[model samples]
Structure formats: structure tokens, C-alpha cells
Target chain A: MNKIILLNNRPTGKPQASDFKFTDENKPEIAKGEILLKTKFVSVDPYLRGRMSNAESYVEPFKLNKPISSGCIAEVVESKNESFKKGDFVSGSLDWKEYQVSNGKGLLTIDASIAPLSTYLGILGMTGLTAYLGLTEIGVPKKGETIVVSGAAGAVGSVVGQIGKILGCHVVGIAGTDEKVAMLKSKFGFDDAINYNTTKDIKKAIATACPNGIDVYFDNVGGDISDNVHANINRFGRIIVCGAISAYNETSVPTGPRVEHFLIRKSVLMQGFIIGNYVEKFPEGIKQLSKWLQEGKLTYTETIVEGFDTIPQAFMDLFEGKNTGKMIVKI
Target chain B: MNKIILLNNRPTGKPQASDFKFTDENKPEIAKGEILLKTKFVSVDPYLRGRMSNAESYVEPFKLNKPISSGCIAEVVESKNESFKKGDFVSGSLDWKEYQVSNGKGLLTIDASIAPLSTYLGILGMTGLTAYLGLTEIGVPKKGETIVVSGAAGAVGSVVGQIGKILGCHVVGIAGTDEKVAMLKSKFGFDDAINYNTTKDIKKAIATACPNGIDVYFDNVGGDISDNVHANINRFGRIIVCGAISAYNETSVPTGPRVEHFLIRKSVLMQGFIIGNYVEKFPEGIKQLSKWLQEGKLTYTETIVEGFDTIPQAFMDLFEGKNTGKMIVKI
Candidate 1:
């Protein structure tokens, strides 16, 4: 029997395991213009939390009692479509199911020889593209400039810090744990890393870490941490608002110091970046990210859990700061 | 003897008369390569409030016991410099003095034949440039889109609303009083106006006014009013951080709802604008403004207080929303 996960309820604040429902299903059959795909890897992310809520967001919310979908790599088990063949691997937005039927519409035939199939859901996929495009397009980091990344140990943040380092920037990472902080500096090659959870005064810690002042801020975690980063921001700074994972769990509206004074006083620019909007420039982003990965200039880490049943728990673990890098579910 | 207004003390909160000292000095004679200037119109602005404090800003803070300077119109009383002759009017960042000597550095020779002398310090000058540049460059309002201007009765806001109309946008203005609100619709050609001071709920009022949602916001007043604007902001919105008159006088830091969720959800862009940064684009900005003014598409209002003695009072009144448009003191 095939298994599938569905949104049992629209998550209120912090998502719980009960919010999702998993059930057994018959393997979906392939039609004349379709292909039957066996799910290989599923990408679970903090941004997925936004889609779990019934609010207007960058992406549409997942419907109740329907299959929850995200970026997934699948193998063509049975093909009736001319565009895809049996045993071929493709990656695209696919549903959470052991077996599903697709018309081969948005799927990209990714090569397994170049990298691991699971890496297609991470460093070489949307994760890398988000980091590369968001940092270069929005952050616009200059050589010798200080670049700070919040949620620094996560999928996008880890990649962003690596890219910043490659660009010859004074890259700094802010994460929750000392272990993640150590990984950011030792593994990701960030100049420094601040454990925000341990730091009594995040603003002061940022000030010390970025003595020259933060010129570009890659914000994945927003709220008071972002507010503290603003305090240490430099004149003519650029803030790339990627994700507000920090505020995603809050039932009440998050309040903090007004930004107009910082913006006006410093002549700063803050832009919200959604990677889907930069599809036309994906080739450029992918090419650069690929080159860096090949040259060993860029490195990535992932927390993979085996089995289809671990998907919801893996997603929920994201908010608890459980995952250090890309959180992936391999079935 | 020459008359001058000097900053007596760095204001702690709202500026008082005691914060300024009117002093007398001997009028300076013009030397070779220098011109004697007689102050004609003194431009008093809310932004001057920022300069009065020792805080670092886009512009330098006013030094204690030193004559405060702003965009002023002056007549050439005597000329030893080739650039200027007797009776020629020039505008520049001039000192707050009845008579002063200049070497014609950084001064723009104004044509009284084109507009009034005081108009050089206003619509034809920095105020016009700020509105035009901040709105077009940052706000980037597209035709049929909704544009909202806060502090819509003031100098920059008034011009911003007019320009929004010219750009074929649905222009909405937010001001403090019923009179200013009426003027915004009647005189400034704003499609809708909201009296924020009297409005029970600013966010609801904004939502009602902008049914299509706010595509662009020209923010002159920050704090709660700006927070309300963000609530009504649409996806891919643009906010121009021109000024924050609302927070200028606050003794403590002004706090509000955090902007990350709003920005990230919408893919919005928020940029702070200072007119000085766009000096290279001044010619382009001036040409557009000049054409609009000449064609009668753009009209301006001024609250002119008589004499240099009223300069400090006129500036202080800006915080009270006393000025309909540009606040000037005719010396």
C-alpha cells in the first residue's frame, strides 16, 4: 500500500504533529499523458510553515484533507508521457505520497551523476538558489563589507554565509546553539558566529562581531533578532528580508522599534525577496552556485531522516531549531 | 549690525524658544571673490528638528551656540565675485543671518523672473526635488495603482500626492486636520484624504480609501501612522521613507509593529530617501517639476510667517501640523 500525508488542519501558530494526517492509499495509476512517480526525497523548510496557515502569503496555503506538496525528487516508475521515461529521475513541486501521477509539466530532469539526488532538494536546488539570489540580488555584498546572516545554521542561511565568504565579505552568522555557531565558523567559514540564544545583549554581541558595522544583513530569522541587527547596521545598509521564522509561531502581532528612523538616518534599503519571483534569473544563479560547489568554494550540510512518516515531525522540528542545515526526508 | 539666530542648546524634546538665541553682530564687508548676501526668505522645516539634536543623521547636527542653516533665498547686496552681481538672487544652504558674506560656493543663482524668491526655497527647490525623486525613484508608482501619502498636507507630502495624481495613480492623503484633509483633495488633487488625528482607526480608514490596496506609500510621518499604512500595503508594495516628523520630537525611541512579516509576505521594497544623494539626477528632476509647474499641472501652498524672528516659531509649529504646505519665514 502507498502512504500519503494531508493537512488535517490549518496550523494556528506553531505547527503540531496532529495538524497533519497520514493515511494509506492505493498507488496512483499513470494515464496516457502522465507518469507514475515514486517519491525519493522531500524538502521540509521553515517557509513551509507559512503555507500551513490559511493566510495570503507568497505561496498558497495547503488545503485541509488534501495532499501537502513541496519540492521533491521522484523516480519515474511507470511512464505513459513522451517527456519522461521509466527509471528517470525528476524534481519539482510534488505531493507527499509514496506514489503519485504527474503529467511531467514542471518537473526538471536532474542528473544524479553531478550530485546526490537528495542534494537536488538542497545545495543544488531551491535552497541554494534562494541563498544565492537573495544575497547577491538583495544584499549586494561588497568586498570587505560586513554581512550578517540570521538563522545562520539553517538551509538558506548556511548557503548564504558560504556565498558571502566566497565574495570576500566579512561574513558573520547568528544562530541559537554554540554547536551551530561552531559549525558556522569551522565548517561554513564564517569570520565569526554569535549564539543569539546565549548572548544576553544581541545588539552588543552583533556590535562586537561586526566592529566595522553590518553593511548587508541577510535576515532569515526576524523579530527582536532582526531589530538587534538593525541597531548594528551601517550607513547605506541593505537588509534582505528572506524569512520571518521567528514570528511564524506567534499568535499575536510582533511589535518592536520603528524602522523609519534607522532607514532615513542611514539612507538604507530593505527589500523582501522571494526566490520564485527570480525564475528568469535562475540559470545565472544556478550556474554560479554550481561552479562554487564544484570548486569546493561552497559546502553544505543536511539533516536527513529516513521514512515517509518522519516528514511532519521533520517540518515541526524546524521551528524548534532542531535542524542545523537543510532538513530533508528520504523515503 | 547684523541679526542672527543661533542654536542655544540641543533640544531635549520639543524645541522651546529658549533653545534658540537671537544675537546681533557687525555686518561683514565683501572681499575679493566674495559676495554680500542679505537673507530674504528663511526656510524652516521639520527635518531641521533632526539637525537640532546631536544625533548622527543624513545631515550634520547643529552645533551648540552656532547659527543654524537651511535652504534659504538671499539677494546679492554687493558683489566682488564674478558669479554674482548686485540685486541677483541666489539660493543655497545659507546661515541664519540677516546679512552674510559668501564666495559664491555651492550657491545656485535663482531667476526671480521665473518664480517668486521664496518659491526658490520651496517648490522649485529641495522640497520639490525630494517629493519627485523619493516618489518616482523609490515608490515607482505605476498607473492605476493606489498611492498613499502620510503627512499629506506638508511640503514634501503635498508635492508627492500631486505627483501621484500626475502619474495616473489613485492618490490618497493622510493628514492631521479636517482643513488639511480638505486641502489635500481640493488643492493637491488627492483622490481621497484621511484625517488621521480624527480617524477612529487609521488602518481601517486606509483600507476603505484604498480598496485596491496600497501599491506605493510616501511616508513623511512615521510611528503609528506608518504602522497603519503597512497594514493596508499590497503585495509588491513600495514605501519611500522620506521623513518621520512624528518621531522627531519623541524623547524616547518610537516603537511599532515589526515590518518583516508584512514585507516578506508581500515582497515589498522599503527605501529611505535623502535628496542630497540624488544630486546627479537633479537636472532631470528639476526639468520634470519645472514643466509640470509651468503647465499648471503642479500647484503648491506655503505658510509664510513674517520676519526672521518668527523662524524658530514657524519651525516648531511644523510638529503641530500647523503648516499647510511649505513653512517659510520671510526675513
Candidate 2:
């Protein structure tokens, strides 16, 4: 029997454990040109919270009673497809199941030789691609300019901060905890870091950290934090809105201080960003990111929990800010 | 004697007559590199309201008890500069006075035979340039896309709608009055017009008017009107934040529905646009606008108030939405 997780209900506010169901099903047979994949590493992300609701988004909403799917690393147990062979590792947006069948359509062959197999789901996966593309294409952080990363300890934010430093920018990170802020400056080489939770005024803290004013804002968090960032934005500032996890689980539409005032004040360019918009340049971005990782210029951290049963709890822990970087489930 | 208006006070809300002081002085002399100018047509714009306050902006705020200045077309009564001669009509940012002297640096000599002298203060001036550069550079309206213009009857919005139509976009205009809405559709060639004042549900009205969804929004009126426009914005939508006339009078920072949620949902690009950022490309834009005017492809409306004393009232009327087009004070 193979275990699978299903979206049991539409989450109202914060997603509850009852909203998901774990069920056992017999592994299905694979026809010709199909490969049997055994789940290895599952990437649980904050964005999954959006998919749990049936709201129209960049990606399709997860249907109720259907098996949940996300970025996953798996081993090919059996393959009738010539493109994929047994014993090979692959990475793709795969279903949350112990065993699954794939035609190798969207799956990419992964090798443990170059990097850790789990990294294919983290630093070398959608997370890395998102950070690279959004900053380079949308934010366009110029050298000598200040780049502030909100949710700076998160998987994507951590990478964005590193890339900002590599681009010869003044990198400032904003995280929830002092521990994460310490990691951002010490481990990630960020010029400065602000623990937003401990700070009396996040806006004033941002101003103190970036004395010259923010030029490039890689915003992974939205709401007042984003508005505060806007208050400190410089003329011709570029804000790459990657995620708004703060308001994702709210039952009703969230409201806050209007943005148009600040936008006009600084003549800023604020754009909402997603990786899919630059899918065509994924190979180019991945190549650059991989090179940086190999050259010791880039580093990543993952909170890996053993067993597929721990997947839901690991996801719930993300909202509580339990994980420092990428949160992955090991099977 | 020369009559001049000065900023008597920084307006707290809607500008009043008490905010301006009229004084008399002897006609000023011009230096060797300067020219004497008799004010013809002075452009009283909504943006001038931003400069009335002592806030950091693209242009310096008006000084208390000092002469107020704006875009003006004046006839050269006496020439001390070789570049300009008597009887030549030149357009420049000039003080609100019946007689003033200029250094001839920022002034552009205009031919009365080519276009009416008053047009230099309206269609062929900053009003035209703002609409052109904002749409072309920031909004980037594509042919066959839907473009919405707020403050549709005002100086910049009226031109933005016409340009959208010229670019083959389905143009929709949002105005406060049914008369302005009618003018937008009939006179400005806008495909559709929404009267936000009478419209019960502005969001629904926008959806009905722009069935294809808004791709490019030239927003001159920001507030609930802009928030409503965001409801119908398509993926990859580009918003040109030209003016926030609605909130300009409010002493406090106006609050409303937050924008980041919709920005993320649609991957929209919202940029605060001013003509100054593209100052280097002014000649190119002006040439294109001039050609359009010459070919009869472009048309403009002006609400010209007579006498120099009307300058303050003309500017104040902008906040009331009294002008159907460019508001100009002729002396």
C-alpha cells in the first residue's frame, strides 16, 4: 500500500491538519512510456497555502479530495520509458504519494554526483529559479544600490540576499527572529539584518539598516512590512513582490495603508513576480545559480524531517516560522 | 506696473483664494542673455498642487510669500538674447505675472503659424509630454489590449485615452461626470467610458466596460477609483501612476484597500510615472505628438480662464473636477 495526502477541505484562515487527509492506496500499474517513481524529498512551501484555497491564482487551485502535488525529488523504481531508466533520480512537480506514475513529461533527471539530491528540490529547484529570475528580471538590482529582502530567512529570500551581494549591492535582510537575522548577516554575508519581530518599529529599523535608502526591495512578505519598505524606497527604486504570505490565509481580503502615495513620491517601479513568467530562461538562471553554488559563493540550508507522515506538520511549522530556510520532507 | 501672484500659504486642503496673494511691481529688466516676456497662456495643472506643500518632490515646493510659477507661453516683448527676438512666442516655466524676464535657458521658441500660441501651454506642452511618455515608456500599451484612463476629462487623461486608441487598444475612460464620460467616448475617441460618480458598483462597472480586462491603466485619479480599476486588471497589466488628484487635497495620508494581493495574483507592474524621468526623450515624444496634431490624428480641449488673477482659481478648480481638459489662465 502507498500513502497519499489529499486536500480534505478548503482552508479558512490558517490551514488546519483536518484540512488534509492521509490515505493508503495500492500502487497503480504503469503503461508503456511511463515510469514508477518512489517519493524521496518533498518540498513544502508557504505558497501551497494559496493553492489549498479555490481562488484563481498564477497556478491552479488544489481541488478538494484530490492528492496534493508539489516540488518533489523521487527515484525511478520501474520505467517503460526509454528517456528514464530504473535507479535514476528525477525532480518535478509530483503528487504527495509514496509511489506515483509519470510519463517523464515535466520531470528532469537529477544526479547526486553534482549536488545533494535534496538540493534539486531547494537551491537548484523552483525556489532558486524564483529568486534569480525575479531579482534579475524584475527588480534589476544595480551595483552600489541597496537591496532589502523581506522574509529574508525564507528559502527564496535567503538566495535573493546572496545574489544581491554577488551583484555588488548593499544587501539588507529582514527576518522575524533575531536568530535568523544573525544567520542572515553572519552566514549569508548580508551587509545588515533586522529582526522585524523584535524591532520596535520595522520601518525605522529598515531606514537605519539601509542608510542610503532602499533601491531594490525583494519583498517576500506583504502587508505593513511591504508598506514600510515603500516608505523608505529611493527614487527609481525597483520592488520585486515575490510572495505575500502574511495575508494568504485570511478569510477576507486584507486591507492596509494605500501604496500609490509612496509609489509616486519616489517614482518607484513595483512589480509582482513569479518564476513561470521567465520559464524560457530557466536553464540560463539555473546554470548561473549552480555555478555560484559550486564556486563557494552561494550556500543553502534545509530542515529535513524523516518519514512521509511528517509532511503536514512540517508544512504547518512553516507558518510558525520554525524553519530557517527550505523545509523538506524525507521519505 | 506688473501684477504677480504669490504662494501666501501652503494649502491644508482644497486650495483657496487666501492661499494666493496678488501684488504689483514695476516691469523687470532683462540681462544680456535674457528676454522680457509678457505672459500669454499659463498652464494651471493638478500637479501644481503637489508643489504647493513643502514636501520633497520632483520639483521644489512653492516658497511662502514668493512668486508662483508654472508652464507658460509668453510673447517676447523685448529681446536681450540672440536666440529670441521681439514678437516671438516662447514656452517655458514662467512665474504667474503679467510681465517677467527669463534667462532663455529653459524656454523653447514656438511658431504661432504652426499651432496656436495657447497650445504650447496645453497639447504641445508638458500635458502632452506627460501622457505620451508615461504611456509609451511605463504603461507600454500594446495594440488590441484594453487601456483605462482615470480622470478621463483632465489634461493628461484625455490625451492618454486618445493615444491608447491610436495604438489600437480598446480605450476605456473613467470620469466623475456623465458629460466628461460622453466627451471621452465622443470627442476623445475612447471606445468606452464609465461615469464613476453615477455608477453604483464601480468595480462591476469597470468589468462591464472593459470586458477583456484592463491591460494598461493610465491613472491620474488615484483612490477608490484606482482600487476599482485593479479589480479588472489582467495578468501582466501595466499601470502608469500619473497623478493622485483625488488624494492631493487630503491633509492626512489616505488609506484604502492594499494593492500587493492583486499585484501578486496577476503579476502586474505598477510604476509611478512622471515626464521628468524620460526628459532625455522629450524631443522624440514632442515630435511624435506634433506630427499627430498636424495630421489631425490628435485633438485637445482647453478650459481657458481670462486674466492673470484667475490663475489661483483655475488651479483650485482642478480639485473640483471642473475642467474638461487643460485648465489655462490667459493674461
User: Which number leads on DockQ?
Assistant: 1
Q: What lDDT is reached at residue A114 by model 1?
A: 92
lDDT for B91 in candidate 1 is: 95
Q: Can you give the DockQ of every candidate in the order shown?
A: 0.87, 0.82
Model 1 local distance difference test score: 0.92
State the lDDT of candidate 2 residue by residue for B93-176, as single tens digits: 889999998888888888889888888877888899999999999988888999999998898889999999899999999998
Taking all chains together, each candidate's TM-score versus the true structure is 0.98, 0.99
Best by lDDT: 1
CAPRI quality of model 2: high
Badly placed stretches (over 4 Å) of model 1 are: none
What lDDT score is found at residue A281 in candidate 1?
Answer: 89
| lDDT on C-alpha atoms for all candidate structures | 0.92, 0.90
Clashing pairs in 2: none
